[model samples]
Target: MKLLFIRVSLFGILLFNGFSLKAQQVKPDDKYNRREEMITMRDGIKLHTVIFSPKGQTEKLPFLILRTPYGVNEYPSPEKQGYVKDMADDGYIFVFQDIRGRYLSEGKYAMMRFSRDKSNAKAIDEASDTYDTIDWLLKNIPDNNGRAGMYGISYDGWTTIIAALDPHPALKAVSEQATPSDMFMNDDLHHNGAFRLSYAFEYAFMEEISKTDSLYQFGNYDTYDWYLKLGPLSNMNKKYIHGKLPSWNDFTIHPNYDAYWKKQALKSRLDYPRLAIQHVSGWWDQEDMVGPQDAYKALEKKDTKNQNFIVLGPWRHGGWAGGDGRSLGNIKFEEPTATYFRKEIQAKWFAWYLKDKGDGKFAEVISFQTGSNKWKNYSAWPPKDVATKNIYFHSNGKLSFDKPSAKEAKPFDSYVSDPAKPVPYRARPIEETYGPGSRWYTWLTDDQRFVDSRPDVLTWKTDTLTQDVTITGDVIAKLYAATTGSDADWVVKLIDVYPENYKKEPKMSGYQLMIADDVFRGRFRKSFSTPEAITPNKVEVYTIDLHAADHVFKKGHKIMVQVQSTWFPIIDRNPQKYVPNIFEAKESDYQPATQKVYHSAQFASSIELPVAE
Candidate 1:
């Protein structure tokens, strides 16, 4: 019921290279005090929250609130944020709360239910909870500044955006990071309509069952091989249920994008209200690309000029927190990318919006320009002048910006796709499981060379780069083909082929880094909402758009594009036989498929690159 306030210097603060000038040290008299409290809603449902404030004073200060489904006390708290302590010392109250149904918060867990439901679903909404929490904090706590700011990453980040929807009058600003707006299209469960089985299974386990100490240790695998070790989705279900894993039943029951995920996902009815906002994300964050982009675009669409700012770093999810800010895995970026991101971007963003200091000019699009390996601000994403180019594939392994000859299109590349031993894109052993936060979903060190060696994985490479080719924005792979079976799946990977000497360092020899890669569920190729069965032997064109990325194919580096039917155990193998929904698919539905990739003029297959002007 009590809040504390600290003293700040009245002296004018100066900015150095977009970094804050606030002293990094806490004064001897200034200390941070923490306490636990439950925020009760109008309906009387209590949501647990942990409050951190400056010690010693009985005065009130501006509040910064973060509500997350990913528990508060033991949740993956940012290890580097002594900033909370520093901010608390600087007369700011920091609050961390557990969204209902997940940790200490009391209520039946209603997954993703934030907006209005005609079904009369019982759940606590972020908007109502945020407003109620702020109202109580203002009235109960002493010394008064009624302003409140919100910020967090992933689920907590999503809540920040939800808070902006029908925003509280006292809500001043929010920083949302790696949060997804539409869970169906771009989150862990589904990507371009493709089901991410491994990622989702582990995700459900970590979120639902791992509440207890014993469960946390046994039920979840933070490392990479957990998916492969868990074997299959059916196996995961069996082990979880028999073992009495927490939330195992929930994960099993929510097979389709049904009411469960839908309730958890924010509705289009949710509009952005006028509030100071800073959207944050990573270009390489494997899980949620829609978070920052959607928030920024939604705000822009809503016509709210409430000091909207976007900071897109080169790091992965939570990468800016603990990473070196330069590289992940075998990939080594230039210098101090992560350091510059936190010290200059995140720290400064909070200082500007939450503390109400610095120039108010929020950059429309502040991002790290890859390939150039420098920072550039764009007036808009995919800068207006960016030229779109399509690279066509030829039968003889020839790829060019221009169309190929009729002779080059005579026969389609044929391959036999076996579901049992599917191709792995970014797979790795337990020893190398901890990939970059941005690419944790993507199996790292998964050398495509093996897949390239297979007849099933059609391989095509552009002739050595005559000049430096840089790509910014999303990449799309459009294929025209016919399958002998009723269904199929295609995964495209963009690889930076090393100069034969790319080898594993120190221990081994050469190592090559995978630039970016994506998978598409072919049955839902035409329409994600309404899936259709493929007409056997009837030519169909599937256009799969890969996620956005910024990379430079240096002068000598080769651009290798690999197409395969399955990326196993990461993604469940699509039964070649067409089925109603993958969740209900059976082993009897599984069949070997004869897949073809047609590249002739009549059925031209090509990849689209968002070529930067």
Candidate 2:
């Protein structure tokens, strides 16, 4: 009896230890079916990747890849996470990789490093990294069909595009969301030449800390108190410029759009190999305005497959992914549109590409037609039937399609812009951090009510139109103005005023969405790199090209145009001293400047609208 007891106890111990070992190797019954592994690049850099394969037994499956600076395990490791199980259960493989130099990946991380052209051939381009990863996975992973798709949001979006440019034949499709094509056009830095300070600093602050390749803890800025009370962007940097931050100093040092920015821009090189694509954007994403839209337009021009598609929703950032489709904040859409994007549009895109179920649902260009508040689809962007129109600024704050008469001679509105107290360009009276950092741009629609009241903002409006005027395509503003100061910034906002009695529920009462608005820092009139300040009080005609916009004004609604000298925080407060790269300018460079805008027939300031007939 003693010998039998000892044998039974020893057998139990062995069985328990074996079960623990197996559990460590693979969790039992994981829905996502996640597996962590490392893939070594050609140059010995090992990339950390978390892969999700189909649960249970399955045949060869389609693969989708997302390479992100943000960690892959943010939530449920993609596979086990909401709706992702559909892909896994439906026999699809999902892979999330930490980009080189980021967490769990080998090598030093550099900002915007993966997209640069390799003249010396020493660097690892995003394309090469993608190629190597795919090659390794196909050989090592079981049941892969040798076909893959790439999809990403923001930084990951950049890689998706870069991969498409020099793609592997096995890469069949790509879906890039809010990815910047040109780093300069509408990404992090300059828009038309204005310095995007607050947007740049906070973005870089988080990105810089994410590089430690370890766990990062972020302290709340307490938006209402700390960041807002910090006064100016310069002061915020002074307080937060601890040794850990990298991109902050780099951005502050290079205020002007110089080679530093040009090197990082994807526009310089956008030659994509043959691949189907779905590019996306939002009407209210002020920070990354030109990325997915620009990519869609460019790829359509160059791609031979004729397979480019775009979806612009009425949301901000990546709002379409996890949010409801209804209107946000003050701008109510009356329906839940975000649900359509995620459960429907996203799934359809993947199905069309991976499963070869081409439903033709998203084969066309999809954009939100505001004012009308409906979704419109076209074979291509701006459609083939659109037309262009020019609305001129007239005397006494009037705007009209008719050109100013030769007999008309009216002086322009003038005001003094003080850098110390620059006109607030960002939506005001709201929490300071709300506009740029939060979801405040929805209320900030095309409405110019707030800007029209500013002393530095010049308002020009037209009488209620007798007939409807529809506009489609790009918006170009020709400015005929001069300044008493050597340097100044000019902001142009093109607005569509609602009809006198146009009413919604009480919740969305005050929001009058603008059609389009843009700003240009004047010193870099000709070239972004070299800025030439204006001669004091000299009359000069500068062209402020606000990017493309699509809108239609009903008969009762009026059109308005506004020009302002400053838009604080959005664009850094220009010193008006004509200093080189306002980022490095000292306090002495800051000064008050007087600005004037002309509207006479001789100096006609007008907006050239691409009118859709």
Best by lDDT: 2
Give me the displacement of residue 425 in model 2, in angstroms: 3.1
| lDDT, candidate 1, at 335 | 65
TM-score of each: 0.84, 0.86
RMSD of each: 7.9, 10.0
Among all windows of ten consecutive residues in candidate 2, which has the lowest summed lDDT? 14-23
lDDT of 2 by residue, 1-613 (tens): 0100011121122110011011123356665577788999877899999888756645677789988776554334343343343354455788888888877788777768746445756567788789889888888888887788988777778888888887877888888887876666566567877767655654555456555322112233333233334444566456555445666677667766777777777766665537788887877666566788777776677767677888877766666655465875556666566767766677678877877765756646777766566777777775778766778888778899888877665767788888766666545543333222443445445355766576877778889878878776678888988888888888888887666666655433333566677778778787877779789888788887676555667677788887887776667777787876665567777788888888777888889887776
Q: Residue-wise lDDT of candidate 1 within 1-613, one digit each (tens)? A: 1111121121111100111223233334435556678878767989898876666656557788888765556321222153243344356677878777767888755445547442544444777778888888888766657888887777677778888876788888888777777666666567666677655554554444433111123333333445545444556555544534444455455544566555665556446547777787776676676567766766666655646667776665656555456765545567677777666666666667666666766667787766567887877664667677988878777677877657774657888998766665454332212212323432343455655467788877777777888787777888888898998887777676655543433432223445566677777776665678899898998878676666777776677777788876557778888877665566667788899988887888888887775
- Cα lDDT, all candidates: 0.64, 0.68
Q: What is the Å distance of residue 56 in model 2 from its true position?
A: 2.3
